[model samples]
Target chain A: MPSPALRVLTDFKRWATPLPVWSGRLHAADWPLTARHIRTQGGRLLAFWGEDRRAEESAYLVHAAFLIATGIVRTEMVVDPATAVYPSLTSIFPNALRMERALYDLLGIRATGTHDTRPWLRHAAWPADRFPLRTDFPGTDLDVAADRGYAFPPTNSPDLHEIPVGPIHAGIIEPGHFRFQVLGEEILRLEERFGYAHKGVERLFRGLDGAAGARLAGRISGDSTVAYAWSYAQAVEQVAAARVPERAQWLRALCLERERLANHLGDLGAIGNDAGLAFALTQFQALKEEFLRENQRYFGHRYLMDRILPGGVAFDLAATDIAALHGAGRALETAIGHLQEILAEHGGLRDRVVQVGVVSPERAAYLGLMGVAGRASGQAWDLRVQFPPSPYDRLQVRMAVAMDGDVAARMAVRFQEISESLRLQEEILRKLPDGHPYHPLDLREAAGEGIGWVEGWRGEVFFWLRMAQGNIRHCRPQDPSWTLWPVLEEAVLRDIVADFPLINKSFNLSYSGHDL
Target chain B: MYRILREVLRLGKVGEKPPRTQRDPASASPSCFRHSLGIRHVDAGSCNGCELELNALNGPHYNLEQAGFRFTASPRHADVLTVSGPVTRHMAAALQDCHTAMPAPRRVIAIGDCACDGGVFQGSYAVVGKVAAVLPVDLQISGCPPDPDALLRGLLRISGEQVNS
Candidate 1:
């Protein structure tokens, strides 16, 4: 007899993507049992979303994509319209708590077994019973409900008190509320309330064509625009059965690396600022600005938004562009080397970050923490390495891993990733492929679903697309921040309230991405 | 400390010279606080693209502080309020309360295309159209995200007649 992992692989038929994927429809009764079986086999739940399929069939379909040993396996099950309830996977995968809550808030589906049923993305903005993502819900109704309040569980201790931070933070940052229960300076528990940044992006993708949908995907999170656009393009290409040109693949890789370098440079500086090194902030910000300016010079957009489209990239690089890229990489490498030495020798910086905000390897694995944060805590699961597609597969990419799982570990990972990105950029420029950059896509007759998996700067970004005759039916773009945000609440425990900013910056999970 | 000082001096004065522009009387800074403007920023429901440009205003290149503009942590201490994003239903109340908290002579500057007139996110059920729909927008700087240079120029115009770097 084979293990459950192998057994499940046989159960689902293979699906095509850059990553090895197998997808199948399952009976509703087997949803929880299959989730438990995969959890027992040490598989990680990647993303979970619900779709309103009432127009075609009078049932709602819920989908779960899991990261097993081989690759990604997506499973879907149908829920009857009468009950509109499905068994919860929260007991098996604790990270599913928010996704389940959000599923309920967006669609009117109920997760029968979860304890916490309070709203995740709905903040009394609409009526209590009104579901936004349903096919029947009018997309333009502007009526709002009065505040009915959320239930943040109270601490029983007389000694501990709560500190409610803002949906409007002090700095020039996105809005999300954080509630910390503290005894003096030390934190006992932390609960987060988001949805202040939800723009109804998924609903906006309903009738948009491939080009408009790709543009909306890029804006899903501005920082990871390239990743989201590339991912969205890949999903469309898969569904349309179009093969992107060789040069287009290389250019996409180049844009992805540049995006990674820019974000990491900005984050390293912010982490230093949080550690009380103000000089580091100015220096790093200058480096990142220079990098972004170059992005505008070469790629046409600083953030590389809309550079990627359905079948391929919008443009190709000239020989002079390639030479310029090589030159920029060398200069950045030299400057970063100098900064790394200074940061290493700074004692105050080391003391502030070395052991703070620690999440043990065991804790990280159990909680399903992923991406650069996961890599820092010894979760060595980079999609670039695990399931390398195209350029990354050929680049022989190196994975950065640190076992300490502290602020220092995360900073080290960011620095290492920056160096690796520069090296990758140099290699890509040296070996530039010759071909057209784009292939125009026509998905008018395409009627199917596909998934786009890309290792975005923060972590693995998963985009699932369901379309009929070129028009999108449902699309869910999942950010790794969904799992990382809960881990942040865990990282804050037993640490002082003042250190929250430092800890949060170390992880640098996205508020807009998670809220959407 | 010596290396840090040396590196700092080596990279001396990366700030740019301010662009010359005619100032509009409608959005001009009040005479009392013209020397420096303490601005408070509210991210009503942005994609953080506008916030990125806003942060760059404080970076060494644009250096709005040297040009007599800075961000304040409190609304009460602000002379101007810069808002980004089309106002979301969840954030509308908080944004209104923030505006009400400001002292008299308070000016509102909408920072992005979305904030200006609900750019791409217009008419969504969760969105409240635009920043002007909720607050009295005194100035609107439009871009998917207005670049740092545009943001700095807009703020400097609000600061006074003389915009300097």
Candidate 2:
């Protein structure tokens, strides 16, 4: 049987012509199909992006693509580069509502049919005339941003009053403003304003060499540092058609799983604490601390930042560290078991989380939800299981899915994932492949387009890289948080104002991850 | 009831952690002894690595609250303003406003490599550089995202305590 993507491509070729390009295949584009034909096929619009192709001509167009379960991605570009306005995909996909606005904010591309376009990420950071991502545009002029203002949508009904929270929260957190129109604790509408934490990372990528670019990817979202770095490394490797040593591939998997494990532990604790269960917080927090200390003692950095490089990992595991890791994994397993018992005993905690903040299974699939959140809501999609780059294909991942789609479901998924990661960790250490984990990546002269995808703790972290003359032309690290945040607006519908914090914590989407 | 009683019995003296008993660079501050600290953290534009480390301070191990330091929700009640990130253009005004909200004798500490000197993100178009660019910094903790030990040590400095960097 042809792969799922090959089957679609075969069918598309019969009806339409195909267009292809080179220069390391930096980005994906092809002959266009009408929006009607795209919707007819059973495809979900995974991500919508833009690439500045000024060198080809002062030309650029926004890209929108759909990814299906069969390891196949189909791309269809809308407007010609010369024409700035094009039809939007939101008519077909709800997720594109945010992506199209962001595409316009950064690149000055407008979507003709998009409904909500009241500035997604712009937040008046630049002048109306200037698109910062364009080639000819100069850097930010501070005066413009200072004088700029945002017209946040408001409600006028007598009973529906407005409430504004954050950009700066009460706790140790990132910033973003959420304005809600409420009628006596019932939220009529909730609008979110971001770009408060925009660091201009995509623009900064233009100034980096390949290796330097890899370092920045790790810092994209500290929690997913390993996943982002690995994604970038895989992209560089794909562009050059380089083969990583078997040892290095296994080592990378180890780090990715460890990153996943660490995040799950931390979130499990935080989610419990937010629900007003202090005991669960203490138990899980202690477990998380133990795990982090192990990571630091072995991996050097507690968060594993800058550990994964473009070629391979920066450090190698010694026999002693391997032994230490083995022991630590066993200890964690036992501790988690005890924690699970405590969780089971606390029935009141379950009531708080059980049916609270439910996302229907059909909506999750339609919205293209990802990672832990997706799995909890019965979206059977994972990059590692679907498109295993190397080690995971052989690792035999066990998929977990829950139809409940509640805060409890998400937490349960996290728990199951932690168990699975621990099992994978032990198996990897036992079947330790011998050789050097560090490989020298020499991409200084290499140029091409390559895509790297890995199943991060949150979901899938995707990186698209284009290189020329040994310098980065474009780098896009698509954090799963970008997909999760929009779905959160849907999830919080009608929930009481007090439950918002509990619900928000359950998803625990990253502001920095989405802001970038 | 049976499990709770057994656990209480099993749990021995949860006494002082040695690190807090020492007099450091922070104990030298006269106000350190007079007032308990309430820290309000702000993330201008960090990668969230620093925020993760900061969050860990309240975890079971370090437990900053045990040492008379608690994270407060209101800047009005805060005795110190802790900020991270290389002050993004959109956040510059908010940072200034947050700093101004704190009462006088407020200490401002810049944590993480980004906050100290803008680290990897220095000279970017969007950032206004480090905390020094937006607010006066009293103590700066260094590292890409300083580990819990480094942060705890630096935090101890508010009480007039000092330790090896």
- lDDT leader: 1
Total backbone clashes of candidate 1, pairs 3 or more residues apart or in separate chains: 0
For A432-506, candidate 2 gives per-residue lDDT tens digits of 789888778777677866777788888888787778777888777788877788777778778878778888888
**Candidate 1, residue A482: how far the Cα is off, in Å:** 0.5
Question: lDDT of all the models against the reference?
Answer: 0.86, 0.76
DockQ, 0 to 1 scale, candidate 1: 0.67
Chain B TM-scores of the candidates: 0.91, 0.84
- Docking class for model 1 is medium
lDDT tens readout by residue for model 1, A1-516: 224554563477787656678887887777888888878778899999999988888899999998888887798889998999999999999889999999999999999987899989988687668888998886554544423388899789999999998888888989889999999999989999888888887888888888888888988888888899998988888899789888889889999999999989988899999889998989988988888899889899878888999888987788898888788899899888888888989999999898899999999999888899999999998888878888888998999999999999999999999999999999888886888889888888877888999999999899999888788878999988999999989898999998999999998877777777
> Which stretches of model 2 miss by more than 4 angstroms?
A1-40, A74-82, A143-148, B1-35
The superposed Cα distance between candidate 2 and the true structure at residue A241, in angstroms, equals 1.4
